[model samples]
Target: NVMNVIISKKSGQPTTMKLNGVVSTSYSDSAFKFNKDFAISTDTTTFTLEVTWRMIDAEDGSAYDSTDTNSFKIVRSTRVNQPSEGYLDCWERDLFLQFNGKPINAINETMNKLEVVFTTNSDRYKKVSVDITHKSGSTKDSLLALPLSENDSGFSGFFEREVGAPKRDNVLQHSDPDSIILIYRNPDNPLDTIRKAYPFAISKILKFPAASYFDKNADGKVDSIFIEVEGPVDQEDLEKLKSSITLPEPRKFKVNSISVVKGGIALDVTEQSNEIRTYVSPTDKIIVNSGSLPAGGLIEGNIINVQDKVAPVLLSGTFFSDRQDSLQVEFSEPVKHFSSKEPILFSHGGKTYRVELAENGVFSKERFYTSKVISVESGSAITEGDLIWINPAAGIGDTLGIKQLNPENRRVPLKVQEAEYEITVRTVNNPMKPDKPVPPEVVNVFGEKGKKVPPNGVVIVVEPKGEIKNKIKMDEGKVSIYDVVKHLVKKDIEGVFDEGTQKLYFIWDGTNEKKRVVGTGTYNAVIRATTISQKTNNRKTFSQIVPLGVKRK
Candidate 1:
């Protein structure tokens, strides 16, 4: 981010000032400063300071810049009786600079005030330190202060008390430069050495690993989390991690709202094999679909290992009516074998289904790409919309051969044939007016008990006004569509069906060969519904007709 500062006085030329802080390197910001001659006249009390800034693209210099300006008043500073260079000053709050011999008034307090600066590289996993010798000053202890961590302060606060202390103390803990780095404070007249002796390391980064576990209840969410590190953790670093690592709400798509899980269980820490481990159970779970849960919140802090991620996947599942009691499930990885012993093997609709090996059941011992297709015969007849999930306790394995913390649930939408079939043109244009020649308007059709409707289940033919000279041949259950006219689309008619709403909507935009709209006319539209018997895969079709009228106006 780049910022330009301008100091302007009434009816006078504005002066552009340069700040001393870091700029453009992406994550760090430095203070703005101008030469001693650039300080506004001590006599001018009312002037304006306008700051304009834009973030430049790091890859190329192009910027997603802003045209707005942030302005602040150089509020009048009450004069205080003091030595020439001994005045106190502040820039709003977080920054404090004491000019050795400048008086405590507004104007002469320009860029001459020495600003403390800290610099770091990148936005993740790095060494960090503080630099206070912006230009040497009278406070010896203040000059000695160096940033311990991105978040630690030492003795530097004594020099800038008039400017509020930094609000963030973890700027150096990670790669982000936005964290506030605090400094130690000391008195000038009555010097205290106790705070001066505060010791801290300015450059050290401890790499760590983090991982998330799946929710046990198959509620489609994540509730358990863990982090691992080598050896014992520094007390200070541990505190920083606890304060910085937050669990964001789970989301399938990107969104920018998050809040801490209230009444959340505190993290639990354990030590093993010269490694430190921290775990936490959330008070509430984060819901998700069948894929990897985001680990962004963990990666930003450089606490997560890119290699330790687990993604849940569904392999395959199919229904077989040859044996009404059998269903087969295959996983991408080998699973712990369960025979007829485990009682609560499969769960669905709040009930446990027992499993028995079918005559063709096979349990392969292979790892990934395993051929262990599980064939289980249950007593209950599997009906439509039957979704069954395996209990992880029953032992499903991930690709690593490790028992899955939460395995992907299986979905089963059964296809069945209903005795009676119904079809109707639910909607179509009546005296339709074409926008842009012939705008496509939906010609919706409904199929009753259409759960088994085959693809291209509906075929439609538009017969122009007075085209039917004689009645067409019709059978008890079929309509003999003569070759006199062909359906607009020679392919199957595709549609979507909402089982809950029992609605099927079809689209017919009227444009055809050469993309020409059918000439304005009154016409008859015949629609047919086709389906296959799920048990025998045989064709079943039904037909209906409706009137359509169009106008080019």
Candidate 2:
């Protein structure tokens, strides 16, 4: 029998030794060592072995064909070292590799089948390399030296090359034609370490690159495309690269509704326009077109949502009755109360009026005329033809924090003339009369009208010229002016009045609203009566004013 063994460095050729064997009884032992002292060399980290065994019948000399050979490799490990042997703890370093800014996984493939990417995590390694191994037992592993020719330009943003560092090699080894393999190598290190094997497959791959934009806010779609390549590139090169990146084409956008509006404006969008080829950003709202539409003209197509970039517009605003106490203003949308913060000036004729929130204050959520409403009590009386400028300094904005624009359109033109009021007052001598029959157990929540009659005080009765219950004068579906009975002079206003008895009675002392008594002169006991439904809009408005005389005792 003959036993032969060959040992060699993992990457180098092997040396063989042949030994003669004899048959033994129960136990047989043979010890043999290599004549050449095996030393841990500077370049050899591992070794491979080949063993061959053959048995021939010595009597026949015609050998029975029973020869077999086996090959195997051994890796040097530090923890496995013996106390008598000097060993170095040489562990392979970690090299993190990514493709197109993403960690490589078995499922995800690269754009180019020919490209294998490697990224160095630490500066410890003097050199980095990759090896491509095919299932067919062929490897195309090579060292990579970076700063390729294209990196001379400004395209370094893709891949930033470390200055004053060793060059990186192109690790995509394509020499082996049978199959492809992925092997990364750190060849120069003398440490007893093996290359980190990255299990990758490069076959039956798609040819084109995929692109995706990244949204910083994460509100919706991607916001940007960050290309990571090893090079410097110029603007032209970048443009070419950007144009070449294949992303799903953006959907064609169409206008939903476009119209000439006197108040608020919008480019209502149902979808994004085709012009945006990258992504449909939720923040994208409006796109200005060159075409023009006449006033009141309407155009319809697709719609795109947008932030309200326009200024606060007064769609319709009205003063309640003749009293300048309160005014209701409707805006195109909910607006910031800039008028409260800044000076809201109202200009009428030659006089200027600084408008502000009334003692009653303003509301954050209120609406009128199917839009946002601003019910304000004036610090001063707002009369007819008063031009109201809401924060002429431009502080008002929408809910999205977009500020209002166009100073000229912010003012409220008090176009409608102040309503004319007519009131009649009469003093009756009879103070007491037969008590009117009352319904028992029916308490009057609102005090009885004309009760506790004032003998010398005037009895002011208001009678509407028309069926004046709630008069809603509207212009283009918007309330131009809402007029109703406010209250009687020097008396609390009552909401309920027997509509059947179209007459409203109010009793008051012969004094003004300030409760100051007048002198003995022939003073007109002006019975200030207000229009109805203006209480929620509380303003000193009178539908009629009556005058009566009181003689001194």
Candidate 3:
């Protein structure tokens, strides 16, 4: 028997046959089978196969002819029309494929198996076998593969597989491949096979770099640990990554969240076990068991330095009435900064005053002092028995950023009278001639005998009250007496404070510093008293003028 075959594309108009062949066939057991090899154009969408057969009997010499025509739809080859980049989950040792637009019939009931071969740069190939099952509701255009689980044995007509350990290890050892090939063979014609190559780049390989601990308040405790990586981590893979991190014994941490930073992903972690102690130590090794990262471990970071945990103590507060009436507070240690949510209060005459404290101008290495001038809005004087204390909400931060705790109602030790000194002046005529019995007179008035002296001298008595007895020391050569007798005569006269009488006496002679007696005239004696406190060593000066009339003898 002789047979002829022809194939033509079915379109609006009948086109020429793209393929034609002739073959001789034989029959066995009343059945005839013939095989022919031919090539068809890829652009053909639908084609019709026509076959004509002629048979002749050897004895009768009669010929019989038969013709048959059949139409077949030409489906496109299995190809990766839209292939997305893939990422490797280092913790789970899984490769995630996000490709779409593959032919729906790539894996069907007839051809129920698909093989994806990943060829590395070293020319090593890893074949992934995917067992496909037909689904009723599968779309006709494309097959969307759901994420594959490790236990999934069969999937729908889509490529989904959990890579084996050996093949994954082998593939990871070498560099990533430039492309991957999808192989599918037709069950009807084994010789007709489809192999589609797509650009396959393992865009990101998850890694765990050196981690750092952070102290948000600078209190020498770890608030969070940031783990940087080279790729983006999905939310589903976060738990796996969290489980892969191993901390030293007795130290525990929790991975809170993952965020994208400048370079890569950051894993925010907090200490879960210890609050007082640090979460991690310098010597402790932080190991991340991931397939893509280095197997050695992460680089250890510097340990956080422990700071002074003790809060600053309020030592003493001294009230000063020197140039400005201020209250100075001293602390046990140096203070870096301080602030109060409410006002630092001072009660004077049953009225409250807000005092704002600032850094003291004087520097002391041993301690810290904050000074604030006390001023009442009601003009009430800050006296003894009046309260001066800091608010409870005041925060006095030390050099190590530790704030003072429970400062509320902490009274400052203040002696308002210690800073206050009262001065009274009295003059005596002919003080040099004590036997003459000259009476003492108030320095404010010029009496007949007190004003008209014998031109010898006058005695000025200074009585100071308060804590200025032996602590009054003159600083920087400040003259205590000035006799104005038609000229400025500054006398360097030293006076002794008699503790018994509670008085300081200074005698001014009729002669100036030149030792010459002045002509008979009225002279004014200016007395200045400078007193320094023993507690704070602060100096205060009081001045008084006494007028004396001198007559030449």
Across residues 78-104, which tens digit of lDDT does each residue of candidate 3 receive? 663432553322111222123343332
lDDT of 2 by residue, 406-446 (tens): 44444556643334433333334212122322222112311
Backbone collisions counted per model = 23, 45, 0
lDDT of 1 by residue, 413-478 (tens): 333223343333444334455442211221222344232322221223322123221122211122
Each model's Cα RMSD: 28.1, 23.0, 21.5
Q: All candidates' TM-scores?
A: 0.30, 0.25, 0.31
In terms of lDDT, the best-performing candidate is 3
Q: Where does model 3 exceed 4 Å of error? A: 1-316, 319-419, 430-456, 465-486, 534-538
The prediction achieving the highest TM-score against the true structure is: 3
- Candidates sorted on TM-score, descending: 3, 1, 2
Q: How close is candidate 1 to the true structure, as a TM-score?
A: 0.30
Higher-scoring candidate on lDDT, 1 or 3: 3
* Candidate with the larger TM-score of 1 and 2: 1
Worst lDDT run of 10 residues, candidate 1, spans 190-199
Cα lDDT for residue 410, model 1?
38
